[model samples]
Target: MALAKPSGLYPCTRSLPQAKTRSFPSLLQPKLHPSPNPSLKPFDATPGLSLVSSSAPVLHLRPRRGFRAPPRASSDPSPLEESPQKDATSEYGLLRRATLVGTATVASKILGLLREIVLAAVIGVGPVATAFNHAAVLPRFSSSFLGGVNGPIHITVATTLSKLSKESRRQLTRKMLNIMFLIGGAFSALTYIYADEIISLTAPGLQVLAQGNLIREMAMNQLKLMTPCILVSGSMAVGFGCLTSEGENTYLALSPSITSIAVIASCAVYILMKGSSSSSLNSPLLGVFISSGASVGSLMQWIIQVMIHKNSERETKFISWMDFFNDKDVHKLFALMLPATLSSGLVQITSLTDLYFSSFIPGAAAGLSYAHLLTMAPLGIFSSTLILPLLPTFSRHTKPSSLASLKENLQKAIVLCMVIILPITCTSCVLAGPVISLLFQRFKFDSSASSFVSSLLLCYSIGSPLWIVRELCAVVFYSLGDGNCPLLINLIAIFMNGILDWLSLSVFGLGAQGLALSTSCVSALSVLALLLLLSNKLGGIINIRDMRGPFLLLLICCAISGFTAMFSYRMLQFFLSTISILRLFGLTELLSILLAGILGMSAFYLPLVFAKFAGVFLVDSLWTTLLNR
Candidate 1:
């Protein structure tokens, strides 16, 4: 049938003629004989399909198993669909990004450890170290939680940016960057101006100490130097958020190492300048040098972030007045920040509470800081590498239909966290003295300091697993869109922590050890509360009866490892004393810790291996299942 032409009102439409039948080549159709044209060849036929061509010059093919026909030339467009090749490419890109992030994260952690060791060597647990720790409490906490990678600002930026189009993302990012700068500048100025009062408020116990006035002065000076870092950190966080959205995480992960390097260089320079001949440098002067390094490091991070942003194709003006005041997204970002700040602020308050209590105990602040660094190193590795992978799994299983699967995953994650952490916790608890002695007991850091910090480390290690559990539970709550629950729980925990801090000092007379113990106790209670709430929310996520056996076995294995490591250390230390030569330069301490640690790990894992081989599949197989996940 012929089609009619368009009317004047529909001028774009054209007339159509009757179309000829375009039959696809089939097995039933006879193949055309060869043509003399150079482009036409019999061998050009695809395997499993026969080609046919005629005088009018149409190419056709027979449909066969495992063969797809090419699309016929036409004026019509093909419908859009997802492409497997594109998915594969995206997955490959994601894998590459994860690898880069993981590597840089590990490097940053290593440098962080180096920074701690260097600080311990350079300053020891002296007045300078104590004052510096006090001054850094607020800056470090704010920069890390409010402005660091994965912080409130970073998360908000990444989340909001992901939902926007390219142009919208650029606009949102520009507005956010400008607003952060303004807010950060205001904060820096305020902190600098009020540094003295801030220090006094942060560590009131300092007033009671014999050298309290001197320490206070140093702290105020250090706080002022570090004030500008608050500003730089806020802007850097926004930059990190932008990089994260673009999947360029290498610099975001590694930039922290730069700060550690700068601090280390500063310490080295201080050591060289002082030389042993002038070992009595003024504490306040030393504080200035270290604080200056930190400030410079932070500035360098922001500079690099700015350079990266400028080099980007979507770069915007650095300080846009219009965006700062008029942008809705900028306002939205700050609005989002309020809740995040409150939630994180509660946690920091608890830490400051401990600092306030520890100030009267001389080097308690420094000791706590060092012990915390040690406790977090291993936990950080596990959290970043293993537990973080579970977020997507949690997200996927959030549907009502997959509630059972979510519950099962939660159980597995808890058990796996225990399996991996319990051994490390027990080992650390048993070898706290040797570990601290080997790591930090050096030129300035003495036996007394190691003994003091070892107690704190032991106390901190007991609650280490609980810490991981709390993080996991928080992750689950966040995945479920119930972040308020955790926030409320943390608010209660802060009050509880304050009460415990006071009780430890006034009631128990436990001093710094009491503070650490109070933290552990609070952690245990918090985990129990979170679990109970989680169970109620999900109609019970874990079966206590089902997990009792595995949990018991893990505890037993960890306990045995602890005893074995302690005994090994005792025997090794005694043997080293008989040799005398191995005692040179802390070799005896290092060797004992290393050898005992190996044996302890062996004792822990060997039992599990034997259980698997002997067909005792309860604990061993469950852990293996989690590991495979």
Candidate 2:
């Protein structure tokens, strides 16, 4: 699941007043300003107020006083005033917010990792594991694409709500919640009814295996059990968006941990009942428990979000359900939501394609899923902590006069993302085997499984940076009210991804690693295409010529990090080969991993700090702030 980025509706520095001091629910408060000139044409009621018409009458909504817009360039086109101390303070604030979110993300990711580890140990990458992984594709895809914090539904609702008055927000949210619940229910029913057909379509290879009938039956059963999540997940996303719009980010950030914990508890119960021995691992029973746990967890997530919203000062009194259909904002929101939903769906299609291909190779489906979890662990942390907080700033700067600021912010965001992502990519590629071994090489996950997963991880790690870039760039388009661009790009990339997958898997017989490679290649292409189009749209906001220097510097630092990590791991293995103490306690692998990672990061970051490389100031400032805090 992805971290929710702030909708471009509010400035990051602007937050809602305390609930205790408010006369009315904050949901009824309006965040937009009416045009200063009454004679000026009213803007269209499209989400984000993206459509302006001189002849139309603007909505007569009252704007909140004391809410200042972000500063813009002067009429003469002079740059906004900036003092070093003020800039430092602003940077410090951004870093501080990121750290808060990052801390939560780390906790959630650890729990999620534990969930995956438990699943791997209990299930292994066997036929049953592959079946479950395949069965999970649609439910996971729906949850991540439709209901994940950063998914289309959450972003659409948050962005739309940000534009409406508090009263309007409440009415629209209530109606949206109802509508989503109905939609989710209908979809869930369809999925449950067609579970067998869906599983066969997704994992056709399962029908031809030695125990094909058993795997198919297991997968179909799991899919039916998980189908409820299709609905609950969407509802959860809406609740998440509501909380985010109300400025209750802490709860939203930590909510996924609840789902992880639920899964862990469920897994523990099953293990206790069946015992931990490999022979005692009952695939069908375990699959049923895990799938049911996922559905229940999704429901829990939605319930938690609803409870938080109800208790928030932002909550409003219950209004007539008819108010939902009468609201223009609700219609506008769905209009904007449609394209984003399709775009997200297209992204999921790519995942489906990968699974479809991987199913033909024994254990490839499960192996791919395992590798993905490992790859996503760090990606999730950095993307959530760093890129998420910057989204609203990007949104707030989309006006023509603010394009310069947007350009600067975009460049900085890209550089910062690269600084964090590049080294992880490099280090993971070099240390994929050890990392996989250290985290997952116990119990049923044996050396063969480790080797298979590590190969896939290496491919995923290489393309991880591209994935980050693609996501950030897509957000830029979303903020700019050009959702079609990403949708179109995804459509094209999907075709390319399929072709690559076929060539890699069928022609070359590369199996799961081929699927990973195809995904990475397609992601790289998508990033390039997005950059080119975004550059044209912004009248060349990004200059490849200028970015070359920073890109080169990042590459050099990443290379150093990779080499150091690889060298350190080898040295530890060779020197510690004689050390029996670590072996006796089974701490050798763990110690080796920690030492290698620390040394690698030290080698990667120290040079950037000392040499003051491009974008190093972000890390330096964050560190300084951490010390003072």
Per-residue lDDT tens digits of candidate 2, residues 366-416? 999999888888877777775556555555567887666566566556767
* Per-model TM against the reference: 0.77, 0.84
Clashes of each: 0, 5
Runs of candidate 1 exceeding 4 Å displacement: 1-100, 163-167, 245-247, 277-282, 312-336, 386-415, 479-481, 535-540, 575-586, 610-629
Q: Score residue 575 of candidate 2 by CA lDDT.
A: 72
Write one digit per residue (lDDT tens) for candidate 1, span 296-350.
8888888888888888965656765864687777666666556655666786787
Question: Local error of candidate 1 at 518, Å?
Answer: 0.9
**Candidate 2, residue 395: lDDT:** 57
**RMSD per model, one decimal:** 14.9, 11.7
Stretches of candidate 2 exceeding 4 Å from the true structure: 1-89, 313-325, 627-629
Among all windows of 10 consecutive residues in model 2, the one with the lowest summed lDDT is: 49-58
Cα-based lDDT for every prediction: 0.70, 0.73
Backbone clash total, candidate 1: 0
